[model samples]
Target: MAKAKNDSLFSLIKSLTQTEKRHFRLYVKRSGNTQDVKFIKLFDAMDGMKNYDDKEILKKVPSIKKIQLSNQKAHLYRQILSSLRQYHISQNIDIQLRENLDHAKVLYNKGFYKQALKMLDKTKVLARDTKHFTIALEVMEFEKQIESQYITRSIENRAEILTNEVLDTTDIIKSSHQLSNLTLNLYSLFLKKGYAKNPQEFEEVNTYFQSHLPKVNFDNLTFYEQLYYYQAHVWFNKIVQNFPNVYKHSLAWVKLFQSNPEMIIKQPVHYIKGYRNLLGSLFQLQYYSKFCEVLAEVEALSQDKKVIQNLNTEVLVFQFLYISKINKHFMEGSFDEGVEIIPELTAKLEKYQYKIDPERVLMMYYKIASLYFGSGNYRKAIFYLNQIIFYQDVKLREDIHCFARILNLIAHFEDGQDYHLEYQIKSTFQFIGKMNQQQAVQKEIINFLRITGKITPDQLRDEFIKLYNRLQPLSEDIYERRPFFYLDILSYLESKIKSIPVKLVVQEKFDGLK
Candidate 1:
């Protein structure tokens, strides 16, 4: 396994954009801070290096000894974050609300209860408007604190009003948390093995979901309550392979945001994620035309200055823009055209690599590998599959690793490396055996490969037909259908049985969906 990286200050500095770096410099010099000199030197030195090298920093800056270097780096790290926090307050609503709360606390500490309450009142409005119920509840608590200790005389029946508001907001927060927690669990289940693998797992998921799902009046739910409700449904349906319900809930999730359009700027990441899931459901349902329309919407979102509010939002928008467009090509089976994007997406991924999470990077490699495989470029398919197969984090996504290895084996076979086939088959089988999740699809494929050498060349078509017949029944079995989704093994089999290109077989299916 690759050792975990731990260059906190260097990593943060490397993640900063040029504009952010410039803002940090301006923020530090705003008060003409004299003590900021050495940290600035440290920050500049670390930023200039391609990698974190503290000894080299000491060589470059004689003002710092080895013992103090750690402290200087730590100080610089904090200063960068503080500068970023100040810089992005205007761009991020949560940050702005938080700053307002901090200011209100300062005022309250100075015994200016009225001013603090006033600041919190404004903060409350924005928080509630943006569906930040948790923040709004905090503001309410602070308001109650002030009103309880001193009669502010701010409004009539202040205690009764605060009590009622606090109770109502508390209920809303509780409901939202229950729903969001369910969503988190469902999503974690999906990430673990992609989908429910068998009858037992499906039953367990269904029981867990139905038991944990909180009852709420759909019409009366707060924006966040409604959002989490829909999000939870999306994950549960997706895990159970119910694409139609996935489409239903994902569209509802996106529509909830659209109904609250002003919140889009306040919660760009949520907005972007809603649309991303919508596109995902459309792709799974093979709603190609609708998928294209949603893809265009997200592409436009990626460019919207108002919604691409900050670096985080910018990264998510770009990520989904590429994902939805890639899925668009995928639904169309336009593999060659899709491969055209590999170069540009590659460069952009490298640029935004630090900002992007590792799971997404691994997923991108799998998508790229699938594109190559669909394009009849098995060598390139294997190349990308190797990245996932040898990915350092095996525990991250066990199913994807297994599928990638299976695809790698098939790619080698398709590339006519029969001499390497037996070893590949054995190794892949062992890998699957070691895994906790399994599908009959994998077993059948491995079993077929193990017998391939024993079958005569002329009997290959018959063997392919037999294998297809076996997998076709499993296609109707929900627990056994995962490999169909991940590997598209059925289409490959159909292509082989019919002696046609895989893309053509897939495009024919796409045309029918249209």
Candidate 2:
């Protein structure tokens, strides 16, 4: 009789989803049928078996033969055994999940995420009807670990395959291994899902590629095959650029892709895809040196009469602007060293004929202006600042203010009639006032007027007070604190010019003349 009952209980466990299984256990408990004790112990023991080692786990599996169930609850006993046989599948066993989540209390104590994810992927299908969300949560935690290592693994695997001609056993071991491209596609999806358990993982992957991809050659592979390989390579490399550590990887991938013209011309699909990835990666990396070098490579290669004619214009123009602006910052004669290459970039952008977005172009222009300002090329700086102020649509609030401030300060030092600079300030103030943003612009305006010696000490203080009062209602968003640095300058300048014959004014000073 015990042998028959033991067989029956095992059969019942096979059929239920975790939630249904839990419910059935709860049902047996509530029934108060004293005979159900043996079945309860068996179910409890099996669930407990998940967290322990094989030896320990096997020890926990209850000897169903010993539990003596009351014959009156025979109906419930038969129901369980029948359900297990009909629904449970050994093939879908969640071996890793069982280890991590067998006992709820011990779930996080042994945090072996790598193994845990392997089991959870297999068991997740069973979660459809289960209330064991904790199991899923544990699975998600392990998933972060996997994503963190994914790019690193991809780079490592690609290098090993390309140079050492070795296959990664881990890649082969995954049940989904045959679908390698699909795995990369999954990485892309993982990014979209917005849950990176390891933000640092993205960096590791990038570093591996930046350090390794350039070291290999694809001359051995057919152009199409190389294209396909590099396409995926570039795609993964692009993902790494958003992080600071591996941003350099973006340039590395672009250089690798451009190294062989045959790899692209004979394999347009691969080269085109590689180009797209190159654009994305460079955008994220945002470093200037790599930008210039890779951009030079792009310009040099694009000029070859045999190269693809319709390469992405945004990338071409952006690269041109990137290089052009970068050169603008060098000392006057020193810039000629780099400017020699501008002709080709200009040619490419002109051929493309304004495919770049006006706003993005202006951003590049502003970045260039800053570079020029740092390099002390005041003329170039003024030129780019004018573009940022007059040409760009949808100006960023802070950027416009910063540009205005930089221009005004430069005009003060340069001693030239900066009519454009004066016009920009007036336009900025007009834009601010028309939008009911006068109070927002007041402090900056006060500082500007004070710096140019247009306001007296008492007048500047009263100006700040009026602006403060005007902004009192909307104090939540603005940092209402007066900038002390601004006040300090006002004091120093006030002391120097107190006795000078000058009229102090607080109005908009809309006219161009100071």
TM-score of each: 0.93, 0.31
Alpha carbon lDDT of each predicted model: 0.86, 0.42
Error of 1 at 377 (Å): 1.9
Where model 1 places Cα greater than 4 Å from the true spot, the runs are 1-5, 33-36, 151-153, 436-438
Please name the candidate that would achieve the greatest TM-score relative to the true structure.
1
The list of candidate 2 runs beyond 4 A from truth reads: 1-243, 246-263, 266-296, 304-307, 311-318, 321-352, 363-384, 395-405, 416-449, 454-514
Total clashing pairs for each candidate: 0, 6
> Residue-wise lDDT of candidate 1 within 341-383, one digit each (tens)?
9999989997787689878888888899999999999999999
Q: What tens-digit string does per-residue lDDT give for candidate 2 at 170-189?
A: 22222122233533663554
